[model samples]
Target: MAFSLGPRAASAGYRLAVFDRIGSTNAEALARARAGETGPIWLVAAEQTAGHGRRQRSWISPRGNLACSVLEVIDTSPAVAATLSFAAGLALEAALRTVSLEARMRSPGSENVTFHLKWPNDVLAGGGKLAGVLLEAETVAPDRLAVVVGTGANVAAAPEGMPYPAASLRDIGIDIGAEDLFGALTDAWAEFRIVWDKGRGFGEIRRLWLERAAGVGQHVSIRSDSSTISGLFDTIDKDGCLIVVTSDGRRVAVSAGDVYFGAAASVGAT
Candidate 1:
């Protein structure tokens, strides 16, 4: 199956490759980049056989999910390049909002059920996960980098037996097709990309992310490989470290860990 893009992607000179099935869009984009195809190109798969998510978790792709990877050049350090995942999250949220507001325009009160942005790169809806992102970076030249933003969104169906609660657009009564979401994503990405300005404008991105942050003032816990920290999810710092205030009143800045909000015991990741 082929996917289509609107004027924004076209105007940005972005290319697209859509497939009916693939092992993983991120893997494909990485292979192309290795062969010197450092592009602002997007690869989408209608279905995936061996999809994966952050920390190498399997991302099961049914026929109706939106699975895609975006490859772009970056003139920054690997640390900074990784922040594009935040931009991807914002773009995905915007795309979802377009469909959501349209669905509940007449009865706007239902916007409360709309999706939210979890720190890093998770989209939450109905207090469950709606989408995820995985980022990988490769240094192509001495000062040039290629980063792939891989995203898997629950469009038609959310996976069952997931470690965390999951919800899909259709599950929430937001009727949308994978192709349509991709188009909306492209437009949203273009706008967020401009706002990001290659990491220079991340302060704005950080603020916007905070504005949509889920459970910021709520009780939360983050699990490390060997331990867990429980605290109030105060905010995310300037460099994206999660700022949490422990019960002892000590502020801790957690850089990497799986965060859980409330007593859900469910792990929603970026």
Candidate 2:
């Protein structure tokens, strides 16, 4: 199957750019935006040679994996733009469930496959990392902000020896191609992006996100560039800052951090 936009996405005037292989869909989307492309366009690749996550961390996306990015030029502040990552997570999770269920019906296997949203920007399936979302933004003009939300899912392959555990759909008995997942993703994104409403409907998005969120109310450690904070994972605030309730009863809002949970919290935590 080829990559195409869903009915809702197409009707909403979204465009698609499919690449058999590419250095990075996110990079290409950002480059197009910089070149005066004001769009709600999807850039998808069958493989990624130079894909990256937050902090420039390498993200593996060989052929048969889904490497897609969506570009939007909005008038929201950068901080508001960051909340769109939650919508991205919701979209990917929804798409995974939709495709996985179709796979299960064809060949019944493990019917216990579950998906959860990890704080900040990841989707967890059966407690292992299944997909990730990366948000990049640039101020193209005084009032125009260009944002690209990139999503990658391990459809047929998963990298080995990663710091955190990773899982692919095939590993968990879901045998589907990247194109099938991409089609679902565009549809899911359309639904959730409306809920996000260019950051205006973030309150509803936050509620929906917290509903499927993993590690909430659990002990977690957050590590940033300067220091590490260990505490209970309270909730994301109005502006999407992670609210961590410390051991000393202090509530600290973390804007960016690498999160660890349960036994892993003490590895590099304060």
Candidate 3:
């Protein structure tokens, strides 16, 4: 079924385009914006042929996953615009919490049913990877910016043999479709977006994100192009970079890297 956003989106004049298959919704959003289709728009796909995540890693975009991108013209600088990933992560957490509430009502006393946001832009459900957020930006003009926020979430299905374990709402017993999840996600995005306000609300966004952050104080390894750092996952700095406390008590700030908790390799996190 096609994704149908509610009146909130309709009233705001937001545009949406659905694709049966695509290389990447993020790529499509960028392409469309460059073609004079600038908008507070969304592009969604049923499947992807070449989806990718942070650091050029492959993102498996199988059917039943939320492969979507949101694009908009913004008035913020590129540095501030990057914080949208945190807003996107918070939005996904809101959506999951809303649905998890309903699931709990039906199956009372559900244990370990919680959601978390990994540093940068990944969401976790019960400590398992559930969703990812990718941010891309381009200078539309001297004073204006166009940004693409790409997201992928498992709704009805999850992939296997991933670096970190994968999970879907269905695997956790919340049987829903990608379209439905997108509907909730779109609405939730609107809610969290007020806290974004063109990067003016980074402080609040960072605070709220830290509340849902996963591995904040856990033993972890951060992998980069040629090296790895083992330490305790500290808070994300004000500039949105990861701060890791090394085993010997040195604090190192990482602007970008893949984080792993213990033996599991973390994916969709940067």
- Estimate every model's Cα lDDT from 0 to 1: 0.85, 0.91, 0.83
lDDT by residue for model 3 (79-160), tens: 8888888999998888888777766777777644688888778888845788899999998888788899999998877888
**Which digits, one per residue and each the tens of the lDDT, describe model 1 over residues 47-162?**
98888887789997889999999999788998778778888889999988886776677556554466788876799996579999889988888989889999999999999998
Candidate 2: segments with Cα more than 4 A from true spot: 268-270
Following a full C-alpha superposition, what root-mean-square deviation does model 2 have from the true structure?
1.2
Which candidate tops TM-score? 2
Error of 2 at 24 (Å): 0.8
TM per candidate: 0.93, 0.97, 0.91
| Each model's Cα RMSD | 2.7, 1.2, 2.8
Sort the predicted structures by TM-score, highest score first. 2, 1, 3
Q: Any residue pairs clashing in model 2, and if so which? A: none
lDDT of 2 by residue, 1-270 (tens): 788888888998999998988999999999999899999999999788999998999996999989999999999899888899998999999999999888888887657588998889999885578899999999999978999999989999888998888989988878999999998999999999999998999999999999999889999999999799999999999988899999899999998989999988897575
Alpha carbon deviation, residue 77, candidate 3 (Å): 1.9
Best by lDDT: 2
